[model samples]
Target: MNKTFYSALNKSTVVLLFLAMTVSGILKAQKLPLPPRANDAISGSTFKNQIDTLSVEDSENQIYQEILNGNIPTFLRDLVPISFSKTIKDSAYVVTYFVLPDYLAVGSDTDYFLMPMTPILAQKIAKAIDFTLPTKQMVDQIWSNASVKLAPSPIPPSAQMTTIPVMWEHNTRLKGKRKETLKQAPLGALVAGHKKDVIISNKIYEKSSKPVVIYGWHYQNGTPIQPVYAGHSETYADYSHGIRLVQDSVLVNNKVHLISKVLQDIQKSSLFSGEGVIEKPFYPVDKIE
Candidate 1:
């Protein structure tokens, strides 16, 4: 995370205390876990649509305003119960938090996913919470519920051509080259490399260019092919682009943190007071002396 970015977070009204223990200096470093390998197959993930198909349109409000007024904790507890908002549903959210985060909740399904692909943005505003990019299948499942048709992919997989590899230097002196192509050892070989090497048959590719087809949008051409991009960017998504599905998932990892006072009650009751450090590290011990 940028130092300037850290200074910006302390100035915001977003409550980050809920996530103190999840990671050290997470605000200064967006070290979210890699994409989960969870089986993203759509098994009961989707639920019946709003009693009547929702006429929800996109909403672009200040995330700070939404978090403050929405009482996000309550929304998380419900976990994707049908929401009725005439103006906005999670389908189209361009909300910006303090570090310029943009996302919204498609709080319609059972999991309550967040879909703004901005991890840096999340840390900047959602200081305590962490997020994981929905798996390829998960993205498809949730985006399927969107109000509009998704865009078509601009690139095609089958249409691409394979490039041949060439070595910069030859292991043996170019003197006894066997292939007719290599035999012509043009002086150009010293500076300009050969057209192609036959030994290296495999084509070189950074990654597949297959597009993520959903979200009423398309994600193409990223390092790992994140569905979201800068304009509103992932197969896995980037730290600063697009939305992610974050709802109950935010506090699921921080259950103890969410209910801080409960721990206080347990401590005061002294129910497990005699336990060793395993149960209560703070418990006093008799001196060895």
Candidate 2:
């Protein structure tokens, strides 16, 4: 009787210890805590009001500040993985990358502003979040794989295209279209179109001045309106421009490689860059301010 009671007690204690460890491990696997700057950003409506009174430079600065404070929609936080298979030199390679379901926006999921920013400001935010901008090839791939392909809705060409009010108007229009799209697609579905992507390219490495490479405002038919163009200054931004955040770490053939390194690799660049050997894949933010 004494031996049986001791055995039962030992089994009970071991079971409880195992359960406790499992729960502790699960908790540790959860997402890490947000930065201290999170939860201090203002709402979308308030940002709009503030933009009306701010200059273009000031407004762009504020946009970066809000992003730094984590003033983005909850949906944008969850990244969607995009995978594609390619064959090179008789070897089949699979490349998988993660990207935000939608372009970077400010405010809540219910009411957010699709913030358009200069390449300088955009690069700043990308660095803060440990993300990088897509290459033209990645932009094409993303548009092709998008679950929600919105038609390119271009506001007429004008000087005000880069102004704050125009940015607000464009955001409102996109929200309406997104609402209609959500009826057919899930909330966090990968979305494209409605804005041209500010991408990275070897063009930024051109002699002379730094330029921002803009590409991709695909139609429902998967045709992009804007080609890979680098005519605009790196600091140039308009209501039509968007920042699509790509996770820096990408999986190539099931092995992890940093995106910047992949772009620089001669053999692996084909997986992401159509132009071959991107060399310099990120924008320079030092002097744009």
Candidate 3:
């Protein structure tokens, strides 16, 4: 080969090596494996039907058990990447985390239900599956990076808002929106704005009653309808509530770190949290009776 051919080959090798390194970093950062869905696991719609007659407490328990048992949709196993850049003391840093493409659901890929449960139950499932709830800042990042953004559809305020029937009704509406969105964006792409996230906030620690902090029902234009609010009791879960699991693993400047550890780090916490040092970034789980 001539000198020109040799030089071109060397340049190509360098580009290929850089691409390989970039892919390696992404794979290493999102190494958590989602549990396989059991063959006998019921679909989300079926589970909803079974729980329709059950009380809120009973239904919440069922949701927790079902999720831990891996009775979740296959599609949810596809985690989407969300990242942000921060400049700390003149040094540029990038933090990234893998998140479920959509809200937690119960069922197989063909049939599933977007299940909503109390924060206590959501926390338990998150712990069992090696995931963590997102902070308010993380929620914003997800919304901003989402490929498919649905507009929030809030039902009129009524006493029945928290009922199971209302949940199913809301799910029906979301299904329609998701169907339309998929036409424009591929399946398993990051989706947001359909539901309010059950998030981890300092407000959860402020009250003795263990309130459930919820946020992020964004519009298509990157505006959230609900701000970070912890007004409801920990057990209160409505149709609009969703659980978006963040893999416990996070990449801080391409180095792998546990999300909990990163959030506790004073310097790194700013990447994920606007509020400093989320020392206890977890929902306090009240024991099920």
Candidate 4:
């Protein structure tokens, strides 16, 4: 009887030890932390190469969509991918526009490069991101979205140069020497979709000899449609009038070739999402239809 009792006691001790070991292993596994970050930026040439090799058969293809879906390691939260149909240089180009975050949404207003500047000054700011005002079609594409709304100038009320009515009146007519008509474009128009109050088209023309005109959006009034801001005969300098930057896009061998030096710069500036959606929220990439 004593031998049987000792044997049972030893077996019970072994079972408990085995259970403890199993529990310990699970606890250790659960406590493991995330891996270290490389934080490397994708170069411009590398970006172009990726786009070239991408098997973009259509909207359903996963290649270009992968980049749009954040498969790329370094991506900006504020950079929205957009494709709008437009005719450029006598050829059709469905270029992608990666929108910079609204000036208000980038943590603080002062953190960004361009706050308020004339169109000429805005071009200088565009240099920081290695972008420029692309073909007129690119501007029209950005304004194509329904979420697109008007942003009023941030200038103080005292600096009033052109009233909304006069600006609209001037833009509604046929081509003329627009230099005299434009007073000042308030600071609001400089940034895209700064306000949702008004909806307007963003296409502006500033050819040296041609009449400057802004293809305006119709605002709801008693009945008639109105216009938005455009350049003038003299320099139309105001804190409100601004310009947009577009990275170069071209069709090579019938494939979309785009170079975004802006994204790389944003990463270097530490304004990127390594894997977290913490800062600079943006819209999804629109399907090419």
Candidate 5:
């Protein structure tokens, strides 16, 4: 080959190699692993057969017939899953009595029903049931009780500014109407159920130019005497420019008060630990969505 041609080919090869490396790096950054599959144990053919059997049984139900005939809202019909509990065969018949746009009924022992919806749909169904049942007062009572334990103490007049990260308190207890306490030294607050929603709504109200970090404590179950609190923190990125919340889960409670107001009161100390600017630079508007 001519020397000039050879040299040109070598140069081209180097450019190609660099392009390949850049492309590989981009792919690695973008790829996200999928969640585990639910039906991993079943063979594809066996699963198909099970679904066919369930479909046949579903077709025989009078209520299912009504749904197919369009008596119910299509969204409900499409969203509700068919669930069968072998322990309560008669309960299946009762589900049909509600005349809900979507429900399940079992006729055979081998039948299995799986809801074709996501967790969000389950929440919607729960909300719908709450609305029909009118249980807002009960929910409010629980939240109010929870809030009493979580409310923050008044910031001292002397303290001009503070910077705190989002924090959480796990395994806390709801004590008397006025207060809640932790079992150990690092006591945390009992967060209100609506606090997360309130924080997000406030960010929009303020037209915040910077990110808003919200610290919350999550309680799963158990009596107030020995409750569990998991420190949960989320950051809402700049919303004024249209970016939404960018959540980050920090394990450390750098500032104890950031997690709970009650904890701060007990210790008589600053809410955050290592900090630069504590108070939000701008106060959010009182109104929220």
Candidate 6:
């Protein structure tokens, strides 16, 4: 073979090998395990049985029906039987703890009236205990029973800000000099990138404010598609341009920290999807009766 031809062939072989390795690494990465599910050992039968026992009384049946219809008035779902390995006196309260996926903590502890629990309060208890909810239906039940009432005092104007709308789209990259549209990317590739971007954007927003509500809804061109996940939201207050909130589907326990980290990552990468909002401040006098 001519020396020039031999050299060209060697370069071509090296390029092909590099491409093969690169492709292999991407495939491996794409094979990452699915996100973990909430782990509650109580069987569905056992949960039903317990509910049945509690519903023996007529009054209890009313409560059970209320819960089933998503009308549990208290934030704490009906308490499952809890056993403490060791009891402590002067504890002020004894409550069952529920751990949410992504590490969120929910407590069934309530005041004397047993009003529904607030997500903010549940977050406080989750800092200490890792408990699991037996079922998602329980969460829905609690939310339904819980009523939203006017604040005891008017909320400060600064605190009453409305959230900005957020949107998510699949990430697309060109392949082999072909400019591929986002719609053309493999589903897995698009999802992975979108998830990472959400994580990144969330961290950037957390530096300023904690998001009170975080839920996932799909969108195309600012229209709802379908809801995917429900979780907490976080915000960044310090940005000079109006307030920005970054939201994501995070494990309950991992919410606060994960949000902060994701936002910071976005700042570092300077990759923002333009999906977020600044809340409008509410005046306490106007809000309160």
- TM for every model, in the order presented, reads 0.22, 0.85, 0.87, 0.34, 0.17, 0.21
| 1 against 4, candidate with superior TM-score | 4
Estimate, for each residue in 61-160, the C-alpha lDDT of model 1 and write its tens digit. Answer: 2332233233221223212211111112323312110111113332222233232322322322333343222223223333333222212222222211
Write model 2 residue lDDT over 1-289, tens digit each, in one string: 4677667777778677666665454323221122432465677777888887787678878887777777788777767788899997787988778888888888887778888888988887777767899999999888888889999889999999988789889999988888997778877788998789999888988858888889999878888999989999877889899999888877776566788898899887888988899887888888545
- Report lDDT (CA) for all predictions: 0.24, 0.81, 0.83, 0.30, 0.23, 0.23
User: What's the CA error at residue 245 for candidate 5, in Å?
Assistant: 11
lDDT of 5 by residue, 66-123 (tens): 2123332221221111111122223221100011221211111122121221112222
lDDT of candidate 2 at residue 184, scale 0 to 100: 81
- Residue 132, candidate 4: how far off, in angstroms? 1.2
Off by over 4 Å in 3: 1-34
Residue range 1-289, candidate 4, lDDT tens digits: 4677567778778677666665444323121011221234333223333433333332124322332233322212234445444443465544344543222111111112112222333333334334443322333444554242442323333433233322222222211211222243322222233222111112232234222222223232211121333334222322233334343332222243333232233322111212212121111122222
Residues 1-289, model 6: lDDT tens digits: 4688667777779677666665444323121121222243232223333433332233233332333333311212222221112222432322222211111111111101111112222222222222211112222222222222111111123431221111000101111111233244321121110110111122223434434322221122222121222233331211001101112211221112222232234231111112332121110111111
In candidate 2 the C-alpha lDDT for residue 29 amounts to 22
Worst 10 residues of 2 by lDDT: 25-34
lDDT (10s digit) by residue, model 3, range 73-190: 7667778887778897787988778999999888876677888889888888888777899999989988888888889999998998888788888988888888886779866788
Q: Is candidate 1 or candidate 3 better by lDDT?
A: 3
lDDT sort, best first: 3, 2, 4, 1, 5, 6
Candidate 2: residue 151 lDDT (0-100): 91
